[model samples]
Target: MSKALSKAKGFKQSKSGTYLSMATTAYGVFGVAKQVKKARREHDTLRLLDAAVSAAAIVTGLALLVRELKRLGDDDVLLG
Candidate 1:
């Protein structure tokens, strides 16, 4: 692979990358809350369910990000 391609692929493996992922996921969860509130206001059942699902997925992403960060800290795993 080219240098640029390698860098792109490995970017998210770095510690800073993991922090960014966590921050983004947290932001997504906040957005989902906003959607949920809007859905409630509009009495939109489908939108409510959609927001619930999005919230779950974002939480899962946050979990994975935390696990990665823990591994990096505990095992001294190589990052990028």
Candidate 2:
């Protein structure tokens, strides 16, 4: 059980898994955009601000994921 859990944990850091995460995170941008439109339509300042914050967070997350992917690609080979 512990080994299986470890494998699952490791997969999250793998290239393919990182790509999948980035894809899912990218999808959140569309949802945030929809929220922004709705907020504008309803003239809700708070909701619009919330949506803006979410969009910023999503962008930051994608940037971090891209950096991790690049690092993983570069350090793929194990010297030891």
Maximum-lDDT candidate: 2
Model 1 segments more than 4 A misplaced: 1-9, 74-80
For every candidate in turn, the CA RMSD to the true structure comes to 3.1, 3.3
| Residue pairs with backbone atoms closer than 3 Å in model 2 (clashes) | none
The estimated TM-scores of all candidates read 0.75, 0.80
Q: Worst ten-residue run, lDDT, model 1?
A: 71-80
Query: How much lDDT does each candidate structure score?
Result: 0.83, 0.86
lDDT of 1 by residue, 28-66 (tens): 877898999999999999999999999889889999999
Candidate 1 overall Cα lDDT vs. reference?
Answer: 0.83
| Tens digits of lDDT, candidate 2, 1-80 | 67667667677777878889999999998999999999999999999999999999999999999999889974442211
How high a TM-score does candidate 2 get?
0.80
* Candidate 2 residue spans exceeding 4 A from truth: 1-7, 74-80
CA error at residue 41 for candidate 1, angstroms: 0.7
